[model samples]
Target: MNLLHANDRRGEYPASYYTASATPLAPFPMLKGQVETDICVVGAGYTGLSAALHLAEAGFRVVVLEAHRVGFGASGRNGGQVGSGQRLEQDQLEGMVGRTRARALWDMGEEAKTLVKDLIARHAMPVTFRPGIAHACYSQGEADHAKVMAEKLARDYDYDLVDPLPEGLIGSTAFKGGDIDRGAGHIHPLNYAIGLALAAVAAGVVIHERSEVHSISEGARQVVRTGEGQVVCDHVVLAGNGYLGRLEGRVAARVMPINNFIIATEPLGDLARTVLAEPVAACDTKFVVNYWRLSDDNRLLFGGGESYGYRFPDIVKTVRKPMLEIYPQLRDVKIDHAWGGTLAITMNRLPCFLHPRPGLWSVSGYSGHGVAMATLAGKLMAQAIGGQTGGFDLMASLPQARFPGGAALRWPLLVAAMTWYSLRDRLGL
Candidate 1:
């Protein structure tokens, strides 16, 4: 069965705590017939919606087609951390792409953070946009390395938002030390995505739900075909991410899909202090990252573990195992909700922006650092459509590697790789 249909009800969000908290919008009609637009955007998640909103603002008619509800995929269900910089750090990025282009990418990374904060402010989104992300380390050596990376950012890039984690800041006893980035932040991602959809409608962009695109035929004008209808437009953007499947050959090569799960405990009230002393989000050094923060209701919203398979494992047991290790005190806390999301990953953990054909673009594989980068991608796409390629071109210039064994064996290979990483994480290798 198709994972999108098997895993989710068409036009509905998952049974996530995010769904419980989000202010639901009225469902848009499904595409029943042919339509024409200046741009056709597949997937109404952050990238597609943001691109539609900005493109509409630029006086282009845009239509966004979502296979499910807005934010139904990783866009709505992610860890919610608004990370700074690219998925690869500046030091590593400099080595890969050289200083000049790395400098440009760094500037864009900063722009991404600003873009999120600006979108929240300008649109007056209800999602709480809070500052600070603490990177917890498992050992003193890792802590020192974290601190050095923070310092390196300030020294090399003249960006000074990160610092060593303060004493007694995080309540986890297993952590040696950590660093916090003032530039980084978190939000109720579902609400933010819904807010984007609302804003896109207000800006006159059309959105259709339950619009699973079958294929795109490019000619003088691009024709995006759905089961029951179609969209004819001058340009088409493939922003489907993990749910896009293998529709586009180039994106499928670099963007491999995987599942990540999360759990939210019952309101901890004053006991929230036993987890996070502050409101900042926290992510650990594990390859399969343990990311958590306190919800507005004072519950611990923790996300951990990853699966390369199409189906999700036991969501509660999968995430709670790592969560308990971090906060053993919460052993008895009630798990209010549990859910899994799908996100695309690239070889180098950087986003893949592809122009597979003229007038057609594909952007995906944000890895885990998508909240800010994905939003920035929309703006960059809008800029590119308007004859500006400075930022988008730089990002597209970043290289991406294909899965080694083509289609059939990619999942097994990634599973093996992830198994080795999980072993190292267990033994602290």
Candidate 2:
């Protein structure tokens, strides 16, 4: 089976609210002949697109080759929750690395949010920059944990605005109470990626869609060969996340592509107020997180299903039960769109950026924090290629362990582990 096209038919981007609202762009012409550039970036998602934009702004002759259309991957089809910090909590990260480096990573997360906002304003992209991402907890214990985290971030980190919400105020059936992270917010992810492409192209970056990079060879210069043409450049950026295949074995092994699904219900109208009572993106604290928010048009967009195999489940109704378990009031809601996309997840829940070779670089495995992490990663990659490797070294210091089994066996192992986690979530463990 043509897995890519089969998954594409699985409804990841089939007539959703995002697709309906996006400002469609003319198709980018595919690469047809040999080209030379100072830098050749693969994948046109957020990371590749952002890196291209920054490199062009730095006056590098950059060429971006994409396997599919721009924003056609997870960058365009994500939950749109631009969260702060890494997927792992601050304390966990600090424990893995020293406090000094951990703090720097935290700071980068903040910078990523700023970069996104700046890009949005600079491009004048059509996106709803709404505020207030209230993280919901399943129990009072988690809420208490959030409070402690808030205090630590405020005192030691010189960061504030992460306020703990008392249980009395968190009347949602899904959560008791949690922290309101002011730094966190939501966006139209597709619009953001497309906007970055627009800005990148405007800054003179050449982007060729449907030009899949099939092979690469390294020497004084790197050769990126696509199906239709080849690109010879001084530097190469491997920004293809889960779909990148085995382009760079080290980075690819560090991150396994897992499929996460979302379903958009028909418009809720006044019922939305009864459900959330406000316009705030929310996610529970379970290992397999349940995240949901109201669309601009009031349809509830809930994302919380995982499949180990590349293909999504035959019936997406399996996701509805879990979604309703969180928001029981939505038991009768009609699901209009059910789709899934692959996300790169790592062992420690932290994104990994590696310089596998002297002239070749890769940054992937954002876990579930791609919205902000991937955006910043692209910036750091630009710096790395421009002879400033400080930021890259700092980010690359994050702990990384090989998946328990090799590529073929890793998925089954992860599935077994996640099954246990799902059971724990059900048992309130």
Candidate 3:
């Protein structure tokens, strides 16, 4: 996949509302010469930068190489809803990994959310970090399921603040709400990623933007070769996610690249309150979740509607249709901007961490939950490298099955499969 070239906005920022309003930062020069470090990280997105920051804090020299600017990948251009747990349901997770291990994974998800907030506070990032994200459902049956799940979580896991919203409260003339999670929240993801990179650099990690790791040699010490330079290091980390090429065959085969898109509407001002009486981030339970939240500036940043193939539609039109379906009152609202990013997914919709070679590591395939999970995965890997093993091994031991077809045929196969599921979503299955 020509990932860098395929999604080119031509040095111009994506036509995203976030990009337009982003606070500017100084651009880093690309890697120009051969370099050496205690660890070399590929992909300067959340996972890579998080690993670099923690490893640097541990006094290990780290180098981060990116194909584009920081936040250029999915890390920068996401829907900005930071929620707990995996994309799959909690009961499904328990069924797959057993109760004890599933509970551990659930705890890890919570840790991921906390880690993001702590990182933001430490860097003083310019993002309106707020609490209370919700998952709204238009159907009463969905509401009932949400109540059961919330009760289960509270009873068994001692998790609190997961309250089910009755139809009267959330069910306006327009839409109904499902469940509220006080622990989940939203932030400007791009700002968070950029801030994290800045913090990593301040802590003595070298981050080279536009420095793609074209190839690598894995042995006792892994050498990551970029277009302009090489990073000779004791360990190599591939956190490239959907853009991870054939670097490690084992890791690459297990994860499939999936494209998801988001669009922002023109500022709704006070009218936005009419749609969502209380401003809370929300997602619907569907094969493709329709997620949206009020930006700090009050623009309704609605996200959902995915294209499984490495193909993107004219974003505004395709994404706006989905938004209108949920809130038809917004039919007259103008779409200000639209953008898309690719995320990696495994067969089980769980992330995979691997040690393909003794010193080579990769943590990716978060399905659609990469923002927080990626950060946590990076931190755990850092801990493992620093001689703390249990957490990282637990995460790594999670079952990860390869997609049915290899790269050449997987996209079409997934597109076909997801089309049927999306049909089911449309049919309210």
Strongest candidate by TM-score: 1
Choose the strongest candidate by lDDT.
1
- Give TM per candidate: 0.98, 0.96, 0.96
RMSD of each candidate relative to the true structure: 1.0, 1.9, 1.7
Q: What lDDT is obtained when candidate 1 is compared to the true structure? A: 0.90
Task: Report the lDDT tens digits of candidate 3 across residue range 262-319.
Answer: 8887888877875666667777777788888888777888888788755677888878
Measured on C-alpha atoms, candidate 3 has an lDDT of 0.82
Compared with the true structure, model 3 gives a TM-score of 0.96
Regions of model 3 farther than 4 Å from truth: 10-12, 166-177
Query: Can you tell me which runs of candidate 1 are displaced by over 4 Å?
Result: none
What's the residue-level lDDT of 30 in candidate 1?
92
Report the lDDT of model 3 for residue 26. Answer: 76
Overall lDDT per candidate, in order of appearance: 0.90, 0.83, 0.82
Model 1: worst 10 consecutive residues (lDDT sum): 1-10
The better candidate by lDDT, 1 or 2, is 1
* TM-score-superior candidate, 1 or 3: 1
Q: How close is candidate 2 to the true structure, as a TM-score?
A: 0.96
